[model samples]
Target chain A: MKKLINYTPSTATRLFLGLLPFALLLLVYMGASEARLAENPNDRLLPSLTQMGDAIERLAMEPSKRTGELTFWQDTQSSLIRLLSGVAIAALFGLVLGLLTGALPVLNAWLAPLLTVISLIPPLAVLPILFIAIGLGEASKITLITIGIAPFIARDIQRSTQQIPTEQLVKAQTLGASTLQILMRVLLPQIMPRLIDAVRLSLGAGWLFLIAAEAISSTDGLGYRIFLVRRYMSMDIILPYVMWITLLAFLFDYLLGLLNRRLHPWSEGTNA
Target chain B: MSEPLIQATNVGKTYGQDVILERVNVDVHEGEFITLVGASGCGKSTFLKMILGTEQSSTGSLLLNGKPMPNEPGPDRGIVFQQYSVFPHMTVLDNVVAARGFQKASLTGLLFGRQKRQARDDAAAILEQVGLGHALKRYPHELSGGMKQRLAIAQAVICKPKILLLDEPFGALDPGIRADMHALILDLWKTHKLTIFMVTHDLKEGFYLGTRLWVFDKLRHDPQAPNAYGASITYDLPVSQEGRDTLDEITRQLGASRPTIPYKETA
Candidate 1:
């Protein structure tokens, strides 16, 4: 038999190993919930699996009292819409700014310092100002996420573009590529994976901004629901909402990873 | 010789206080392979860059085809640096085809129908000439040093630039690979009728390849204004008849011509 230290596990073994910690956590939670309920059946802090399940079923299956629409699904849809819109806008702007700054010296000199200053400002600190300036509509929330993440994405892609060897630029020029052609053909294809990776990295910050905006001003969103139930001490709903947000984030990350692999296998292992 | 293809008259380059090349004068005619050799900070590569229009001479004019070299890089002047000459992200075939695609078509045309196909075929044929026919799908990093240099050469000349510049293109290859690259380069030069300018550190490589050899060195030194000067073409020897007798004489001249003053660090 191979020694455990040196032996590599097969995929099936790895999958089982991955599940072991979650299994342990479930057992621990079940035991603690049972003990807590025995002591006081009215406890809300540590809701049991049954209570959480009932909460989820109500949110998932039942309609809201005020509107005929399901609250949970409505929240998911609104949050996702805000997130995707913000991210799309940020990605496009970042790509253009990064490309321009990276390719041209005059632009780099003028804009790079400004971008640095902007990126240095903590995005959350500007949330109040954004709300004041843009108002409490969908524009404010989406703008918040865009402002929170776009500078970071731009800075990352700019560095990647600048790191491209000078020889490639000269060669492209020698090949009759004009400035615009070089950007679209040489720099664009090369920096695209870097952009996607940058977006993936900024997703956490994106979510933070999205949630903060929703919590402060929005009517319908995952963040609005989570914060709304907090006043009522609805731990059942809050915990499930938090878990669902994590699952959604994980799903988005997984999909982006899949796209990166499928579209640019050449860039594997080099970028995030 | 018919009117010189390129003329560099009193060309000099300098930073604020530091000098790189000064008062360099040379004329290159058609069908001449010129090789530049010098010490590390002697501005051989800088001269090549100036001709390619990536770098500007602070002082004089460099004329190509009897016109001042353009301020920007264009399809007429091609160059292959030591490495990183080919885009790492592109496959060998795509790297070759990209030259034609950019040259012949606008962005939209290259993306869609007949232009793209034609570019691909042209690129494939050029790759075949460079002996990279089988490795069309391979990325730059996947190739050996020799293969990468070959790919770079193919990419540079695919547009059929009037002049080709090489900067120590085989410096990183092993000796065996370097010899293969030398043969390949010579073959390409003869077939394409390219007016070539190459820079190499190896004296023998410089001698073996060039029809004209340029040796850059600081001939004069000023103790008070040390940084106010630059290197120049201290020796220009025509080696169109590159034989053992000619190389032996040039070797003696090179040995005798080594700078007596301690060279300044200007790179």
Candidate 2:
């Protein structure tokens, strides 16, 4: 008998297999939603597609009845700004600290032990502390995401730096490079693509911290609006908001992947 | 003669309780091609590291240009390892150009405008010499083993260093390709006037390539403490003058007891 490992699927068959689960999921959801709606037209638990679409249009396109402004867009903008600002700051600090900690033993001695403890602490556990210290404004939310993921990113970069061949470092020095020049010229370019990979890995945790911070103490954000509409049991609005967040996460991951491929063609398949 | 381009006196290296190399002594003048061969676990590579300045000798002094060799790697010496010799992120041309960056540039190791063009031209010329002229834009991973080694040699020599250190450079190459690399290295040695130190497992290769052949072996051993005595240059033979003394003796020493020696295994 042929071994299971030996049976490689054709590309077309692989594509079909990839989409089968999602297709099955959607079909099941539609059938369940139909049965619920047929039983009770006012059922909010599983609103029909049209109902959800109308909710999305109301939230996204129309101005809110109370505030005379588009609440959905405002929430999205503020959330994106806070998330991006926090992630950007984290990535910058992560790269610098990682490169230093990874390349220089002096800095590694000073920071690595502390970073281990910081990375282990749950960011949500500090939500109350951040809100009190940085206040209820955007600072607290941004600080939450940054504090949540910077250590992981820094640690990843440090590991990647250490993985570089000791031979290469010696070669660089033999070519008349100083310690700083070796770090900037040799290690920096190599570690940049690795840093991007690390950031992509951290995005899930980043979003978690962002949403958790918003849910606890925020006037606006995707999480804020979800909690706000939960008081009325508005499943229609909640469903659409969730799908929107998923779409945004998928888009950002895809764009960042595309950016990595474009910026560092040689790094392709390295992690593979 | 001319203060010997490099001089080593009672050079030794050890860990906390284990000796790796001991009492390595030799004087190498300019344009000498020294090929080192030994059984596995011998300290030939460690000696190379000491000369390369990454590993300082635990005792005694290694001198270059009549002064004690710098404790860190400097532009006067270049090395090519068995693998990972070239930067994966750089194209064949850029790999050599980066050597120029280390040589002339300050902190950033980057050039601009006229300097960039000049560096590129110099790199291209060296690449052409190494037979990588057609693959200048190809990254290291895209190249085959021989081509990558060629690129390594080019990068190592581009800065016009006085010494070129190669550690089993052609060990991974096919026999035919290894012959080609031998010719290329010999041609580069003469044209560039480089004093070469190459480590090879193949006895024939050391005889064929080097003006002098060094055999690294431990003359004494303690059964209780395996690493009590480290390897030293047991026999330093000038290949050009005395290669025919006895090839059989070396093959016996490296092959009879140590059946696992890389050269005999492959041969």
Candidate 3:
């Protein structure tokens, strides 16, 4: 073979390398399911892929006998709406609060300690409080996710804002920017990309809070469907649902990454 | 001679009880290139900050154009720091145009077509002058050290400030690049007729570029009473062709009399 300056795997090799572990996992799961079904054909603990596919088709394509709605789509729509609403609110609130706390010493003195305290309290522990105070409806669940994650997002943005070099702020002032101008033009644009990254980082916990809230009192969410089917040992639906949630989270993460790369090319190495 | 462009009278800075600089007095004339040379922690940077109006004098007043300078920074004074002088997120072209946009409009007005094209044209012309015309779209991090400093100067000078303050603008560059920067600064100074104040530890650089040099050092020292006093302008020289010899002689005499004590511990 001709000598190469650097060893880089081809695209096909890279694809195989990325998929190998997942393929192995599926193989092991199928093998176990096949052996278990052979011994006990009525086994529900580990459903075969065929069984899961049938369940997914029923939930997704067929209308529910009682409500005349595609149950899977309904659950997905409700769950996504709640999750996105909570995340959007948290991100907006975090940016404003973080900017205030980071830029102004007086505000930092007043709000930073309180925000620290809020961030420390276990979000799951406060689910009951939210349900009680806000009523056991969509409001409570969305509030739960917001409460669980907003403080963290806020804290991340505050620290990022604080870490902006003093020289940049002074330089902005020298360039004829007023305090408000500095905050809006100089600080806001810089903080936004980091804020998106912070949201990306906090998303896993956000999903946890969302699912927990949905499992407790939700009427028609993905988490509600999962918990509702658990009593009947419906592994076919549950397993696929779990995978679907993971796939959704992955998709959202990928989209956000693309958005960050597109909108804020300046943040590549520094943030990524 | 024209009236003094900047005048510092007994300016002093202190952080609570500890003094950083004291009894600093100077009269900077129009179109003069002045350089401040001192050891680290000798309050050279602090003195420059006072002139920039970012920091206030705890004791005396700093006057610019016969009026006491404001406590805050304004467009009348432009400064290029050693690092992070360019806004990292902005492109080179955007960075230069930002000064024009900000000076004329608020953030909302800037978003609309309220002179943006004019600003871009002006900025492009300035960038061409600074030799960064080809790199207008590049970010600050994409530029070499020399290019970044040149962009910083372009951004500062575009504002047409009466005074341009540089805090070790070439301190981070290699010798070859530093020489290029020195030439660029001198060229800009002559073209703009700007009053410039620069702080640097390189004695040769201070002696070379400046029309006048101010050397800050601790004149009074007692290890037991360290916080009792701090640095001051111990030697001031007017760097004329013949005055260069006098400056060298004074530097030799001062070095012989004053032993070097690390200012870090005292500071």
Q: What is the DockQ of each candidate?
A: 0.42, 0.61, 0.48
Model with the higher TM-score, candidate 1 or 2: 2
Off by over 4 Å in 3: A1-17, A269-272, B108-114, B225-227, B242-267
**Residue A127 of candidate 3: its Cα lDDT?**
84
Displacement of the residue B133 alpha carbon in candidate 1, Å: 0.7
Candidate 2: which docking quality band? medium
Model 3 lDDT vs. the true structure? 0.86
The CAPRI classification for model 3 reads as acceptable
lDDT order of candidates, best first? 2, 3, 1
Backbone clashes counted, model 1? 0
**Which ten-residue region of model 2 chain B has the weakest summed lDDT?**
B258-267
Query: Which 10 consecutive positions of candidate 3 chain A have the poorest summed lDDT?
Result: A263-272
User: What's every prediction's RMSD, in angstroms?
Assistant: 4.1, 1.7, 3.9
lDDT (C-alpha) at residue A87 in model 2: 91
The candidate, 2 or 3, that scores higher on TM-score is 2
Q: How accurate locally is residue A32 in candidate 3, as Cα lDDT from 0 to 100?
A: 100
Write candidate 1's Cα lDDT for B80-175 as tens digits: 989878877778988888877778557621544787788788889888888899999998777887888899899888899989999888888787
Clashing pairs in 1: none
**Global CA lDDT computed for model 2:** 0.88
lDDT of 1 by residue, A67-166 (tens): 8788899999999999999999999999999989988999999999999999899887888888789788999899989998999999998999998888
Give the better candidate number (2 or 3) by DockQ: 2
